[model samples]
Target chain A: MAQSSYGTENNNFGPGVAYSQLDAALLVYQEAGGRVSATEPTLDLSIHGADGRVLTGGLVADAVSGATPNGAVPSTVSQNFVTPLKARGSTASVTGASGGSTIIHLPPTPGQLATAALGRQYTVAPNTLPVDKGFRDHRGAITLGWSQPLGAISDVGFGGGFSRETDYQAISANAHIAQNLNSANTTVSLAVNSEFDSSSPFGGIPTPLTVMNAQWKTQASRNKSQLGFVLGVTQILSRRWLTQLNYSFDRQSGYQNDPYRVISVVDPSSGQPTSTLYESRPDNRQSQSVFWDNKLDLDPFVTDLALRYYKDSWGISSKTAELSERINFGTAFYLEPNARWYQQSAANFFHYYLVGGQPNPAFASSDTRLGSFTALTYGAKLGFALNGRSEVYVKGEYYQQTGNGHPADAIGQLRQQNLFAGTKAAMVFLGYSWDFH
Target chain B: MRRPLLIILMAGASISIAGCTAIGPKPWEKDLMARHEMLVDAYPLLIAADEHIYFSKEASSGGRGFAGGGCGCN
Candidate 1:
């Protein structure tokens, strides 16, 4: 998701003084085994007015490159796959090890010998996961927000954002309102958000469940629309504790399938892939979740705890818990250590591979994201205060995911293969924030 | 699921009512609450970045607030 300026319902900068703040950060993320790596740079600026009005703007750029799983299961024998050539007419001959795969030309069809070079093919070695190492993309996004105190309400805000990648574009907007009660000890807030996205894959939108082919698809692009809302409450439990709860609902419709992803159709008895079919997913999804968080101040140390439960119409449910503790070293620096645990059930239609002879399901996908899994994230943040209103911080985190690699109903050769595609990753973030009049 | 949710809601309501009636830091004793580190979202940008990464990797998202914008990362 693109970075957003929404959900700032509790950001009440008491009246009297006006100042502008600037925050800049750079993040580097890498998945284990050279799967995916991303570098992102973000900048945000906010100006506060004496009368409680605030204006904010932000910019973010991302560069991502590395191999990504192609939703295919490993097999005992080497496999070959083909997809539409990215470029139409470049004399780039079949390059060897072109992003971890050897590219080859396909034979001419019928009388189209002259245009036989319209597709690109690659070979994947046996007993190895199929991945598209050629994956690389760059994205840029901008967001703007304005908030101020209304007549009766404590605060009202509006935000909008736009993001663009090589083959994707997204536009989003949100509005929020907050009210303080009980001597400003209890706060209630609500936020509504909407987003529209268009996906124009390099090869076009393929027909779901159809055999994977190299020919370009006719459909140029597809679009999706999302609408969501959140209701939140924050209460000061005591002089040293603050707690918050939020409930959210979201609905999404339209193209929800990954155009480049395919599922293997295997021989029912041999457990060997016979062919691959484009993956499919339900066009509409509805989801709901509840989050609870608490913050406690203990003199020189502070503790934070959060819990969340989520459920979706696709037959997926999840639970999450995160805890963090910050230790202050006088007034100059602080260290925060955090840990998070998460678990989720798989989507109803998730599968490792489809049997060739059995009837096809209405919706099916092999995407590992839809599979059941558990993840753990452990990290720490170190921050140094350069002055009363300026600080520099560095955060490091490690994430690991695990899933059932061996299923009870595993077929032939698949019984010996590890179907789990979860990933391990490391992330580092460096940031600096300063205030100015 | 419904049972747990109901229990939580009731507990939260009870706590809120009790806290409102009994606790009083008065107005001047809010020094601790007024600190920047005490804010609910003190590290807004950092949290946003973390959420962005998780959104791309996980199947579920957006419980704390409205998740704005969309990306094709998943």
Candidate 2:
């Protein structure tokens, strides 16, 4: 037997853990099959490093809000429920299914009736977020790269660094080789990078799809590995302009899901949530991207324009356009304003929520990143040169994301709620860089 | 691994010979091209930070850098 808090308005019961458990099991199976590494595509891959060792580091703070997962808001009472689940670990139980298989009990929605009538049990969902739907984080990272002349016409760069946050950590090593030709007017470069990461989220690792209220097992952390390669060419189109083209490929494998996200299990006909299920995703992904960038210098001002096309094995694709202008205020200071537009197609398994009675899909996630959406970023940077060897800069950006939140075939009350509510985030960065001979 | 390596070899060969046949800036005319602002990646650290933020928040990855890790950003 299981106890359910659905009778109360607190929506205290979270989603199920079995979904996540199954998801984890699937990932294990995928790993047993094989693993791959992934890379990112950027224009800088082929650039020659500064002659001396240059060290760069920054501190970034970000504030994120208005990201309502699946746009599923709890009842007024639950919204006011002051007791955060983070204070206490959820408890759940598993029972033998009809053919000796195991069946897990998951948490019900705000108004769902207790499952005692159906001879089923219920468990709470994982604590994926605070009821307020906002969070803040700080991050810091630093890298040092030095280039050595390989010959009269070639150079090689070696670098490594790490980025750290409260819950995530990554360490990477990279190398690039560049060669000049055509009277030094044209250059070709190749770069490769490998990264490893370990993430330890708060509340440990959530057992996929396990009943949140039920006592399920959890791991303290998970790991991921990535590998990338880039091939690029830079051409001096004229005295005041330059252009570059690059193609990059990357592959990643290991745990790949937000430990705290969940999907609503809704009635097929009514579109009303019956229960909540923790989400899961594939363990391995491979992606590639192509980019083109052009820069034009007009004495005191410079303009940079770029375009990118990206696609991945998960059936996700995206296009990005960016433009920026740097205006010099004498030789000591500069102001650069930048804007970017991005559009992406949803992952194949992206769904607002799974229908309650349908057979669960092999993969499913309510994470908005996997959904179709458009995002815009507007930002500016102010930089000052302290001398020939050092500089300081401050930058800020406002990012907004929006997408189709309502499905045409949505059932009952779901048609009235916005599943794709917009999300906004703001970030600020303070950075310093210097070169040492 | 093999494919990326092959592409690198091919691209290197082509680029090394491209200047021999192409018409563009001369060696002496590349002074401005050597400026940091003219480089595709003018701000490496800032770009790295931005990529990290977007990776944590977005579903798609692999435009500016390789995917590094799976974050529990939610």
Candidate 3:
């Protein structure tokens, strides 16, 4: 049987044979309506020692580009927005076509003869979503882990990872321990993880709830820290049934706002945007969740079911359920079909837009992710066993989200607009795994 | 919040009771349980990737395991 330990799965091989497995996969994701697209390639290698020791390493790279919403409501009239240029003092001339936007020299601050900086401006057509067409970034990440059996304990492991992007960096570390009991039918595990992140956007951090402007702000960067733990239990319910339960707790502190996101301040009666302000969120957050999963073997097929409940200090609550069934065809191939349902309530401070005359809340965001919504995902995987030690698989999934587009409290033209036109996305993955001695 | 906590406690208690019933499989009868498809985390990497995508797009994350890494995507 597979050892129920972190980073030690699929280690049941013949005695005295040292083996290593390599996994490579490519993921392609695209959102409908040209919002965002990403391609990621990942490679992982794990080496298993003869004496129950394992070392694993992985590398991943992502390229993302495309338009992304700026958290502004659709408007009847075209709107123009401006942001600081990529570089501070570059003399490069403005281009007519720059990612569907234009770069223009900003007028000098009063009493100056020359312009101080360049700003990029994008225009949104009437009744269209305001998106930043220059949204693009590349990221690379690496992870390393090691695990080994320690005397009476099933496994103990510690791992660390680092990922870097154009504007962000993250460093994380984790440790876990597992114990087997009841004649190896039950396994209990505990894992703790910590992460530190630095966000240094190209244009500097903006003051929360301040007017969105082309002028650069003084705050250069911000950092966030997170700590979390998970406790899990795995049990062999029967010869053909296995079950697992997990409870997790997480806490975060420091900057939590998306520096680039904004919220529209609209006229109270007409629902027309009068100004835009940077979004804001609480600096500290705490969350907890429970997950239960089961796998049942039924001769030619296997069934997997999982359920999760999550709650957070931000007044956001969520539930998720997923099911998958794998059908085996002889010994060389298998097909798995899966579906997932998820729903989440809005954060207490989520608003489609702030009213111009109302007092600003201490914490507010127009990001749809903080709003109530339901999502469905359907997918299937096809796997081909090339040999006893190698396999190839391809999977595709479709995801759709829906929410109340028009609230009863919506004012004037806002009632006619789809405030929550949720997202639709498609993803595909191709993967290969090989084990060698 | 209280209701969900109550449900979680009840579920945990039920599972604990089931574990104490001694209805688990014997070591000799673990062949079926040993199959790859029967493992609790049959596709760890795929699940990890899925979780990453969800973390970027959703408001809630991390129940099946500790969230190992942080990103500024949200």
Interface RMSD of each: 1.7, 8.4, 1.8
Query: Ten consecutive residues with minimal summed lDDT in candidate 2 chain A?
Result: A20-29
Q: Which stretches of candidate 1 lie over 4 Å from their true place?
A: A1-15, A88-97, A106-115, B1-24
Instruction: Give per-residue CA lDDT, model 1, range A168-211, as digits (tens).
Output: 99999999999988888888788999999999987788899998
Residue A183, candidate 3: alpha-carbon lDDT: 79
Model 1, residue A336: distance off in Å is 0.6
Instruction: Name the top TM-score candidate.
Output: 3
Regions of candidate 2 where Cα sits further than 4 Å from its true position: A1-146, A164-166, A214-216, A384-392, A430-437, B1-20, B69-74
Model 3 lDDT on a 0 to 1 scale: 0.85
Best model per DockQ: 3
* Tens-digit per-residue lDDT, A1-437, candidate 3: 33333354554454345788899999999999988899999999999898879999999999999888888887888888888786654446765656778877777665322456777889999888788988899999999999999999999999999999999999999999998778778888889999999999878898999988776666789999999998887888788888888888899998889888899999999988899899999999888888889998997899999999998999999999999999999768999999999999999999999999889999899899999999999999999987666789999999999998889999878888888857899999999988776
- TM-score of chain B, candidates 1 onward in order: 0.76, 0.58, 0.73
- lDDT of model 2 at position A1: 13
- Candidates' lDDT values, in order? 0.85, 0.60, 0.85
Worst 10 residues of 1 chain B by lDDT: B1-10
